[model samples]
Target: MKSLWLSQAGLDTLDNTVALCPNCHRKMHSLNLEEDIIKLRDKVKNYNYK
Candidate 1:
């Protein structure tokens, strides 16, 4: 899972969490990619109005 603790987005909230595959999760941390962080934040927001 991609942890939101150090994320630029909100923490400990339904709209700030998501499950990610192992490889994808590892790559995100290793790369420290800002784009990936943005994507993850956007992905979590999908739950906002649901």
Candidate 2:
């Protein structure tokens, strides 16, 4: 099985470590999550789930 580690924006581990999804074996360097909450709300209004 693989494992993952996340280094928080700090110096030490006991107070600055973040645990990520263990299956991913590497540290997450960066994330590019766009805040599309408004777009999603509008899209869901017109989307048919069936």
Candidate 3:
């Protein structure tokens, strides 16, 4: 249960949130890098469109 953006602003907004599985969520926080998150986001977007 972590905020992907690591920001308090718009925290309750659906568009600002991502529902990640526990393992993935933990990994994300551990990585703790915006670039990594953005890369993952692009990958998911590309995957979904394919």
Candidate number of the best TM-score: 1
Off by over 4 Å in 2: 1-35
TM-score versus the correct structure, for each prediction: 0.57, 0.25, 0.51
Determine the C-alpha RMSD for candidate 2 after optimal superposition of all C-alphas. Answer: 12.9
lDDT for every model?
A: 0.72, 0.39, 0.67
CA lDDT, candidate 3, residue 13: 71
Candidate 2 residue-wise lDDT, 1-50, digit = tens: 21223333345554334334653223234432234333434565686758
Cα-based lDDT at residue 2, candidate 1: 55
Worst-scoring 10-residue span by lDDT in model 1: 1-10
Worst lDDT run of 10 residues, candidate 2, spans: 1-10
Error of 1 at 24 (Å): 0.7
Tens digit of lDDT per residue, candidate 3, span 1-50? 33346453446676566678998888887877778777777775676533
Better of 1 and 2 by TM-score: 1
Distance (Å) between predicted and true CA of 28, model 3?
0.7
Clashes of 1: 0
Q: What is the alpha-carbon lDDT for the whole of candidate 3?
A: 0.67
